[model samples]
Target: MRNRKNIAVKILAVLAFLVFLIINSRSISNPFRTGISGAASLPLKGLNGAMRAVKKIIPFASLREENRLLRERIDLLNRRIEESGTLSAENRRLKDILGFKNAIPFSSIPAEVIGRDPSNWSNSLIINKGSAHGINDNRAVISMKGLVGRTLEVGRTSSKILLITDPNSKAGVIIQRNRQGGILVGRPDGSCKMIYIALDSDVAPGDRVITAGFGSVFPKGILIGEVAAVGKEPGRLYKYAIVRPAQDMTKLEEVLCIR
Candidate 1:
């Protein structure tokens, strides 16, 4: 049985060779026939298909890498855009502050807010400008929004501002809406309390408050803040009111020094 099986395999191989030889002979005699070329090119076509599969996988990996790189570039661009926006806003605010200083009759200096009091509730800031820059004690410090504080202590190159919200700081203010007068005093919690406001005064919430320039500390017409709330104690002689400071002290970055 084994001998017969071996003979059968040899016969099959010999038959296939004869078939190939016949096909080649016909194509050689008839040039229009494609049998020889088709048979000869089969191995190359199979190899090309395998290569195509490999090439397809390569592109997929390349596309994934490319997408990752593109995402990284987008992230970098977004960060740059955010920084540019912040810079533009800062430039505008600084320009406004400069314009305000230019319009005033007093000599002015520019300063950058460098630090704040460790006590968060304390209304004070340290500036980069001081005696060296002509900033002196009691010089008014202001921002685009309004009065920030007065220079409390002066160093060679830096100064500390006693913010209007400091408990010891006070400003004589008038109600812009009705010309009522009051003493604006800072509370420990960063808001101003209006003292000596008449009980029957026509003051209301949202009234604009401005420095009266009576004490000669702050300039007239400098915006201080808007009325936040109003209330009266049962036996008090005056109505107590809270004023929201125009300058957002927590966000202060730059200021003008008025001499």
Candidate 2:
């Protein structure tokens, strides 16, 4: 009896498998078999869904890489633009200096500033052109704005400029307002103190000051600075005032040596 039961169960299992195969074969052959095809391809549908997910991730990865490359390109372009602008500005400044050099009545030698005094109060610089370039002591140096200084010492290939703000330096200057004349003397700090003006002189703020050409060091009509402030202390014979320098010594780069 047990052997007969086991043979019946095996026959049932074989029949069930045969029915499944027949249904799938019919679905494959007939286009109208919708429900049967869906049931048969459940596992394949899951694999298709996984493939679609991978396809979506591909676009996202590609987009991220494109963004990174674009950022790098933008950075490169910005650097190039900055370099071009700097070159253009430098060329303009050099052109202006060349034009000024040509217009000057006195012959001049061009010099590049090589070094600067470490102390802010020193107001002096070293130039690459010196005695070899025909630069001599007491020769004036100038820039686009106006007079800078005079060559204090010269070497074979280098020279030192004694800035107008040196304490030991003095220049004869006149006020452009009323032609009131005074001497501009440097203080320990980097400012010139105007002295020898009459107590009743009419010098006011914002008046332009220029080299008077009396001392014969700096040429006449060279701009020095503007009158910043004026004051009269008790028992003082002359009015004293401070003058701001026209050229900024901190930004000195190129200067002309007046022969």
Candidate 3:
């Protein structure tokens, strides 16, 4: 194949040189010889044009292949960029969790929110740490902001949590300014209410609520929420206050597991 291509190139070069000489001839006096050369050059010129067309085609296919490879490389780089963004976000979240863990004085296990209960989405969640990592049922769960929930079920490396906003969940809390204590219970709508507050109590909205340290389940002074509203009925014996949780339960990502 190499020898054939070399021969074809040499033949074209010779024909092109013959054409040049025939067209620019000044000393040729024979009309027969000049006309014969012109006729021979006609076929050679067409052949040269065909060779140029083929040469153009060869480079075009190569260029297309190079363009295809470049496009693939760009796509790979784009995918890597997306993955880098995701990892950066994860690193930031992990740093926040670490800072929160360091700030707390008590012993706790840091766990990542892995999943949630689909059947009762508002009530429960799953964490990455479980019985194997010293996490078990009824252990208190909290976030950097405040109390999240308590451990419900435990596995070897995973566990489910009962959110504080769940209607069935309950905690004992107290007003920070005053010693007024009450039962913080969850509502169906995912908010908590402090019950058994006295009507004449000096309680107001925005009062900070924290764990009373009286219960065996949750320890001393973990923040629960802030008072959103105080409710009073004319005939009611006790005034109840609506408590807004410190933690955003809907966005649970990392939490502290206190035994």
Candidate 4:
């Protein structure tokens, strides 16, 4: 502290300042005090004015520089917040799939939906795992709730999913109560129907529908939907049942592909 004080004292010159203070010591509230103060600050004011004149050519020097730095910081923080939220959501989804994975019997792989076809958003989506992970065409894709879709195309690192909500989707399903079988097909407005049930069958509303394991696609006994309505196709002998699929296909994020 002594050394720093000595250095500070040595760097300051008090000759003129001492003279002004001595002259003002006996003058209380005098105009000379203000005049002397203004006179003493003339050099500093001139220097500041000169710097501002130079800054006029430079166009916003210190303030613009500080604002630029602040903007950069804000952008970086926004990106970090976005990345953090995304990671948290992904972590939660992985945990859910981990729990579901433990309860299933078939060999399966978990994947994320990374892309979608806007023209057919509800019908198809792209997953992050593919042929490299043993995913192939016609492999069933399921969510924690129930069936999600089936793999329609596969790549080395990604695959396309054909959601059962698509109009082209078809799977053999059976009414859980009485084992009445039919094909589940999608519609334009994104609903499904179980076709080919006999009109005389004992099917009713609220009966569960499940996969029949009849085709090479989905395996047997997965809850597909609950029967919402039962009716006959006009002039057709076999009836059709409106089925509400268990999975909310519009909001899929992660799914499992069964091998």
Candidate with the greatest lDDT versus the true structure? 3
Q: What is the TM-score of each candidate against the true structure?
A: 0.68, 0.70, 0.65, 0.64
Write down the TM-score for model 3: 0.65
Sort by TM-score, top down from the best:
2, 1, 3, 4
Q: Give the top-scoring candidate (TM-score).
A: 2
Residues 143-171, model 4: lDDT tens digits: 89888779865766667788887888999
Off by over 4 Å in 2: 1-70
Error of 1 at 13 (Å): 99
Model 2 Cα shift for residue 169 (angstroms):
1.0
Tens digits of per-residue lDDT, candidate 2, 104-143, equal 8878988877666657667777777756678887878898
Worst lDDT run of 10 residues, candidate 2, spans: 31-40
Q: For all the candidates, what are their Cα RMSDs to the real structure?
A: 35.1, 36.2, 34.7, 33.2
- lDDT (Cα) of model 1: 0.78
Alpha carbon deviation, residue 98, candidate 2 (Å): 0.9
Clash number for each model: 0, 0, 0, 0
Angstrom error of the Cα, residue 147, model 2: value is 1.6
